[model samples]
Target: MDSLTQFTLGAAVSALCLGKKLGPRKSALLGGILGTVPDLDVFLPFDNPVDAFVLHRGWTHSFFIHALATPVVGEILVRSIGALRESRARVWLTVFLCFTTHAIIDAMTVYGTRIFWPFDPDPVGVGSIFIIDPLYTVPLLIVVIWAFFSANWTSRFQSWLVAALIFSTSYMGLSIALQAHVENRAETIFADAGIDARNVFAIAGPFNTIVWKVIGQEDDRYHNLYISLFDEDDEQARVYTHPTRSDLTACLEGNDAFEKLRWFSRGYFGTALQGGKVVISDLRMGLTPSYVFRFAVAEYAAGNVRSIPPQAIEGQLTSLSDDLNWLADRFVGQPSVRAAEASGGEPYGTTETASCVERQTSG
Candidate 1:
């Protein structure tokens, strides 16, 4: 989830737990600040962009860390803040709830989070929601804004706050259910097509979960299938192929950072030659052709593969403008049938088959 969502969720959590005692204004402000503290790990230095990308949601977002910090933060607040001194235990409880809610909400997104920290450093992801969804954030933002402006009427704000939380939580559950339905359908479709793929997932596309990008992984290749809730039951998926490579497998396999990235992506990544460099792509995001999280993890020089510190070029890992319109159309404006028909039955973001473009090649 985006930072704004976390901030607003924290505000709701804080206000719900402390609004009656501390008033809405103080609770909202305090909660919003604490909500973002966990994400400050972004400033931590890393050897390369790949490393930073892989470990972005590590121990800092862990529930274990938040649980340990709660007492310290709570005690400091209880002593320093005059309003909270009388109710030390309640203020501590408020801090724990608001802080932990930030990390828990993060775990619900496709981007993984290390909620367990040292016990389990691997990111725990539900894949139930997109990283940023207006449906989940807008309602909570309204409640937070209302609390900030209005001084009194804490009880009334509390009612609306609870309502917004229920709605957002319910939406997350609905996304999970939709994912299951799409995966089951995708499984049947693959069987009919004779694609011997066992591990498959229906990932939400861009803004909404209704339109899913189903991926099936074999040994050295992945199959892409696009399905939408709006289309007829008989609508066939537009399948795309992406080939995996081991061009410099020996070197990349030995690198600790590369292994971490592989684990982070759940092995749904591949190598590509981009601008005469060994580039890695996280296949989960963007469309088939134009992916967002490309990184120049190594350089190829003099017909030899040389390991270089991974670097991400612009318009790859962080660009949103390129896919914004497509996401909007796929999610709301255009019907899925039109998109399937408009492509003339060809998979979008593909060149011939994935095999030709992504075949194994030497430097």
Candidate 2:
């Protein structure tokens, strides 16, 4: 999830764990910092973007790392803060909960965390909630602020914090249920269309129950599907067939960089050929036109045309449906026409918005 959500969750958990033992102010402060510790890997300098991408959310977010690191962190924190002389076990438990809570919250989103790292490197993404959901964060923030002002480790305060956590966690669970429903519906749609596919993944977008990006595997290629959960009657499903090496052999003939990017993106890519050069995008991160960094054959283009030219990649690619029929057909297994329509909707999956939020926060 986003930083604010993690921070608030950490603070809330910390406050509840240390209720009365260490005042609300101290608990929130410590918890907020500990909550953000897992994300510190982003600051590490890497030699290349690929290394950074793979290394990030690696060992730091692992369950084993949290188990070993939390006690040391808790011990240091207790000694420096000098508030909770609690046993090492108690401190370790608190720290573990705080860290695990952070990881669990992250796993709920599309950009999953490697919770069982060194054991499972593949991201465990639930795609139930958006990374930054105001609905989830605002209430938690309200309670944390209330706790900060009250500074009273009373039962009432604990109740508020616990309630907020329950509400958010419940919502997360509901989102997962909803995704399953959407996936079943999508399967029916494909079956009706006579398309053999498996391993369908559905993700709910931020602040809305209507939009989702569905990815499924068919034969040697992957299919990108956009569905609107709210509209169950629409017959317009935007489906894109991502080219496998067999599909791209003609296009990417002698291009090594493009091949490397394809490998980097794990075959989840979109390409735009302009001015005799190719611009590739990894759609797993949402569909901002500029989200694609441009690389060209050095010999063909004399002067620089901007790595990813602004003019070449126009509107944001998304799967938003204003019509109910399209939504209905997308879910519940109905036959829908497979044609590209001009959709002015925001792209279904990607962390560009989160990046914008991070940038704003950093600024």
Candidate 3:
């Protein structure tokens, strides 16, 4: 979720838990600050962007770490804030919930969150919702803002806060259900098309859950299928196939950046050789033509692969303006390409179907 959503959620939860004791303004401000504390890991230094990207939502987001640090944070707050001193248990509960809920809701997005940290570094990304969804955030933001400006924490204000929490939580649950339904439908579609895909997942597209992008992985390639909730039951999403280049991965066997990305994406990644540099793009994020994270982790020299420190690739969104237009049409159940025709590129990213090395050699 975006920072505003986190802030508002934290404020709402805090206000609900301790609004009467500390007053609405003070409790909301404290909770909002604490809510964003875990994400401070973003400021920590890393040798490479890939490490920074993959290691985010790491130890800071862990339940164990939160639990161990709760007493320390709670004690500090209880001692420093006179009002909280009288309500030790409530203060502790408020602190704990503020941290835990942040991590839990983050796990709902496609960007993975390592809530378990050291015990299980493997990211937990439900992919049920996009990072920013107005549908989910607006209600909570509205309620939290209302409480923040309220002169007193009245029963009506408290009731609205609780209602917002219930609505947002239910919306999260609904996203999970919608994801499952899309995945199941995608599996059936793949079977009908003889795709032989076993592992498949669905992610909400852009700002809405009505449009979904389903990716099904096979051995050498993966398929992307876009479907809309408003589409007719008989309407089938067109499948776009993209290569994974598992064979090229052997050359990068010992490369740290390569392995980290493979682990980070849970095997949904593709490789391309561009300008003699080996570029890897996380297939799970962005659409085909533009990915959020792309790194040149290795190079080709003298017909041999040479490992290089990961260098982050910048925007590949030459067709982003067009893609957004397509997304809007797709969101409403209208048939459209993922990328615009004027872009003259295949929807996912490129038109090339061959291995990276093959493309270079043939050229």
Q: RMSD to native for every prediction?
A: 4.7, 8.6, 3.8
What clash count goes with each model? 2, 19, 4
TM-score of 3: 0.92
Which residue pairs collide in model 1, if any? 289-349, 292-316
Model 3, 1-363: lDDT tens per residue?
789988988888899898998888889988998899889998999888889989999899999999998999999999999988999899888899999899999999988999998898798999999999999999989987787787677898888888989999999999999999999989988888889996798999888899998889888777888888987763556777766655556678768888899999988887766666668888778876577888988776555566788889863655567777778887788887664223322333323333333222210
lDDT of each: 0.72, 0.63, 0.82
Could you tell me how far off, in angstroms, the CA of residue 53 lies in candidate 2 after the best superposition? 2.4
In candidate 1, position 257 carries an lDDT of: 51
TM-scores, all candidates, are: 0.86, 0.74, 0.92
What's the C-alpha lDDT at position 80 in model 2? Answer: 71
Better of 1 and 2 by lDDT: 1
Query: lDDT by residue for model 2 over 1-363, one digit each (tens)?
Result: 788888888888888887566788778877888888999989989654444544567677888899989878988867876567755566678799889988888888766678998887666667778777887788789888887787667877878888998988887777888889879877876776666867787777545445677777655556667776655453555465553323322334344444445555544555544443334555555533434333332121332222321222333443455334544654544545433433322222221111010111100
- Deviation from native of the Cα of residue 354 in model 2, angstroms: 35
lDDT over C-alpha atoms for residue 146 of model 1: 94
